[model samples]
Target: MQREGRRDSWEEEIKENSSAVERVLKLVEEDAVVLFSKSGCCISVAAKALLSTLGAHPTVHQLDKEKEGEEMEGALLTMLAAPPAVPAVFIGGKLVGGMEQLMSCHITGSLLPLLKEAGALWF
Candidate 1:
């Protein structure tokens, strides 16, 4: 019975993980900009603030606070061609990467064009 219980629990976990992965996939394509972040992460805060300051109001998802955040994060890592790290930025249904990449785009003056292309910016 004990062994069976563990197996059952494992199966349940797998189901939940699958659901989380599906959710993550949907979320990334949900808006012109989607930020998969953690509330406690300063980098996440910075990324959001920067985007907001640039006049782009992105759809923010604090994965760490969600019931399936860990699973989603795990799925993100697997889904992306790069390593998983929060806050993950998705723009125009493309993985734009983390805070550094975002800032680089901003600094290089490419971010606005990308935003415009994605329909997240008009001005």
Candidate 2:
């Protein structure tokens, strides 16, 4: 976590307005649910599976496989201001966070509403 007023690595990255960040911003709007994850990450896979089961059919972008993945990863680091981990999930063109946040919404019965509002689900 970043200190209250101290600067961090992501500060500069976010300022540069890199193409990767631009791409991510575009992707989030293109789909109701966008998941930025790694193929080898089990939690990412599980999150994807869970959304699939819920009929969300989220758009997935794997950082480990793309040509611009490294750049995107850096962008994700800044986008996820909290813990800054993988499996960044965006819903309705909004950042809904990682697996834990997703599960929290699901467990709390709010996931369905989000999905429906995002047009990723009908029921």
Candidate 3:
């Protein structure tokens, strides 16, 4: 009974993880610009600010406040292989990576084009 209980628990965890991953995938697919963030994270705040400044009305999902946040965070970490996955940005249904990648694209003048393509920016 004890061993069976452990196995059942493991199965449930796997199910939840799968659901979280699916949820994240659906969110990224449905939005032009999706930002997975945590409210109190400074880098996330900066990412939001930068996108807003660039004319992107990003679909911001605050993982820390969401009901499935922890599971979603775990799924994000596994999917992106980026530790501390909050503040992850996805544009045009593609991973735009974290702050560093965002900064790089902006510096290279590529961010605006991508945003325009994604319909996150009109200009």
Candidate 4:
């Protein structure tokens, strides 16, 4: 019984520490390019790939159904209300919609310019 209690306490501590670390990381990336995605989403994958190909290393926030709890869901909802979708990109704390919008910007030769304007890229 004592061993089981100890194990449970250890698990709780680990969870708390992990949450704290995540919060710290979120704050550390001041000019963050956040991609709210999930595994097995083709659009999200392509969006991430596009960012990488453009020489931008975005902080990918995988919102797995099993892992997303109230806090995360609430945050997402507050930021992007109505019909929440994957691959939602937030560049320097600004929401920049999904892959379709990205593709449009790319075709117009405007995406890179926008990144530069946002100071997210050094070119």
lDDT of 3 by residue, 1-123 (tens): 986886666566557699898888899999899999988899998998999998898899999898999889887776565477878999998988888888999999999999999999876
Q: Please, what is the whole-model Cα lDDT of each candidate in the order they appear? A: 0.82, 0.86, 0.86, 0.65
Q: What residue pairs are clashing in model 2?
A: none
Worst 10 residues of 4 by lDDT: 73-82
Q: Worst lDDT window (10 residues) for model 2?
A: 1-10
- Candidate 2 matches the true fold with a TM-score of 0.86
Off by over 4 Å in 2: 1-11
Off by over 4 Å in 3: 1-16
List pairs with backbone clashes in candidate 4.
Answer: none
- Backbone N/Cα/C clashes per model: 0, 0, 0, 0
TM-score of each: 0.77, 0.86, 0.82, 0.62
Q: After superposition, how far is residue 19 of candidate 3 from its true place, in Å?
A: 1.3
| Per-residue lDDT of model 4, residues 1-123, tens digit only | 986886676566446556543542363256556777777888888998898799777777676743543345344443443345566776766677777777888899978876776666766
